[model samples]
Target chain A: MSMTKLTLQIDGRSIETESGRTILEVCKENDITILTMCHLKGITDVGACRLCLVEIEGVSKLMSACTTKVADKMIIRTSTEKIKRYQRITTELFAAERNHVCSVCIANGHCELQKLAYDVKMDHIRYPYLFPQCEVDTSHPLYVLDHNRCIVCTRCVRVCAEVEGAYNWDVMNRGTNVRIISDFNTPWGESITCSDCGKCVEACPTGALWPKAVVQGQLNKAPEFISDLIEKRKMKL
Target chain B: MRVRKAKKEAEISKNDPRVKFLANKIKKENYSPGSLIEILHTAQNAFGYLPLNVLQYITKALKLPPARVFSTVTFYHFFSLKSKGEHTCLVCTGTACYVKGAQAIVNELEKQFGLHSGQVTPDNKLGVAVARCIGACGIAPAVVLDDEVLAKVEPQELTQKIKSKLAAS
Candidate 1:
């Protein structure tokens, strides 16, 4: 496949990247590490997390790096106080709604959300905790569910349907009540069509789903390696 | 202005260990709110948390108004203006993990810790939190134990892992 080259300014640093690369990739490649709760690499960009928001010189409102592609002479600001505040608020909203007790969570040490909170220095959540009670489906022999920890990034939904071709999981409901559900809202293990490949669980970034063997504050999932594999595969093609 | 007055009160004491450390690393030149997050991060690393006095010191050093600093600090999830538990756990509840029983793992942890998600244990030994995604979805039902990744875990295994960590500590 032929590639096009484009030049853009990220955080005032001018850099050139191939065409078809999203701003998130460019930023990551450049070591910008934009605050992102969603927009995983190798997966299609859904811009649902809204944590990677940035301000373009000419654009009025902020834009999500995952969805926005770089253009010639485009100027971007990823770390303005305004942008940081926006990202922080989004993170806080996610934390307040669910149970994000990092110390006890399986993903404590390696969790991106926890890291982001640490990175942002969010000591206390100003808002009240919603503690919205949700179901924990452990019927799946390999994994368990903790709805309280979900931030609804939807990487699983996209990866399952798009990357895995299983389409076994999907998000039901909308807004704060949204959650991932199996076929006909059945238990994950009962979903006979599930490949048991464990791709969806691997795609999750939080404790919403994890192998039964991994305890809370002990689960660690790494998608970077998968993204690297996908990148290598694309490069080969 | 309200912002300016807040800035004046946000100075840090020179004798404080965190302030001295920041003073040495964070030059008094070319400060901005954009770098505020980074500065706070450094301070937190050095001081465990961003105390009110530290905020004042940062406001004075960075030449940012106290309200502006406070606002910026409050806006990001990464910066904690208050004290946090010695141990922190982050659970990923993203789509992939959700379908794989991430919720059950969190529930078990909550029950064991006697602290709900996003809360500090009464003894302040641990803090529990949930995040949107950690970019590690392929390891469904992922959790981070103080910065380590334990992927593809089961509920019983999760308990054992925690028990062992506590035992080791």
Candidate 2:
């Protein structure tokens, strides 16, 4: 399979990319920052987060850059006020659920969700917090449980079942009460078949599955160097 | 008969102090309804588990009521309000780890321990869990035991390592 190279314009910058690459990838390669929650590097793009919505010239509605592959002569705008408003509202909706107390959370400083909120300048959650009932499974020794921090991105679920093949983690319920669970909905500690590897915890973009004993104001996240490396590898391929 | 009674008595004492300590700690922190999850982490570290009383304390402290706290605790995979065994073994089953036979290693460990995933032995000596991706995919099939990483573990090597660790502990 060969990919044809094509030139496209993103936010006024002209760049040449492969025919089948998404606009998000094109923008990312060119150092453009687009807000996204559901986009994971080297994994299938679900466009569930809705944070990567971009205004394509001639498109009827805003399209998700994650799912929209680039075409020849395409023009895109990523930062119009309209787009910012949409991004802000979407971020607030995420913040409106569970608990995102940045001051005392483990991922306060280093969380991607927190950074995204800061990027959009969401000083307060305008909408009332749903505060859905959620459980934290602390059966695993190395990590802690805090469901309130989850944004329902499903990155952890996809990485665990699809990428890791353990199928140990999943979003068990639906709608407002949805949450990530382990085998037969058992406690993580009770799942004897679980490998206890902490991959899902690491893959999580928020403070959902953090290391045990991480200080409230000092959660450290692994850098995005690997994601960048994966992107580079995909481009090379 | 006396030995059985003593064992039961000792178990109660072992579980009591940790639970009481967590309850007091959560109270000291003043974790409110909105901040229950944040305090849950603190409780996990202070007690090595989230006991029933600690959850009750959180409900009362946060003013969230009981059912709400219970539902939240059951909703996330990361929360553990129960007691765990002495040792924990986690295998990375991320994309890189999967391609590297992390699954096979997990299976071997399950067999050797005479336990299934998420179960502790009757002796309560060890617990096993699996993670999706630990971001260390470069070293596929990564396994972490008590904060130490064992990379590129073959099936035979894994069994031997677990045996040695269990024996030493």
Please name the candidate that would achieve the greatest DockQ relative to the true structure: 2
Question: Backbone clashes per model, in order?
Answer: 105, 48
Model 2 interface CAPRI class: incorrect
lDDT of 1 by residue, A41-65 (tens): 7888889888889999989999998
DockQ each: 0.01, 0.02
What's the TM-score of candidate 2 when only chain A is evaluated?
Answer: 0.90
- C-alpha RMSD for every candidate: 23.9, 20.9
How displaced is residue A32 in candidate 1, in Å? 1.6
Model 1 agreement with the true structure over B1-169: per-residue lDDT tens digits: 0111121334556787767878775675356656787788888888767777777677667765443455455556777755567777778999999999889988988788776777886766777788889989999989887789989978778778766766776
Question: Model 2, stretches more than 4 Å misplaced?
Answer: A223-237, B1-169
lDDT score at residue A134, model 2, on the 0-100 scale: 70
Best by lDDT: 1
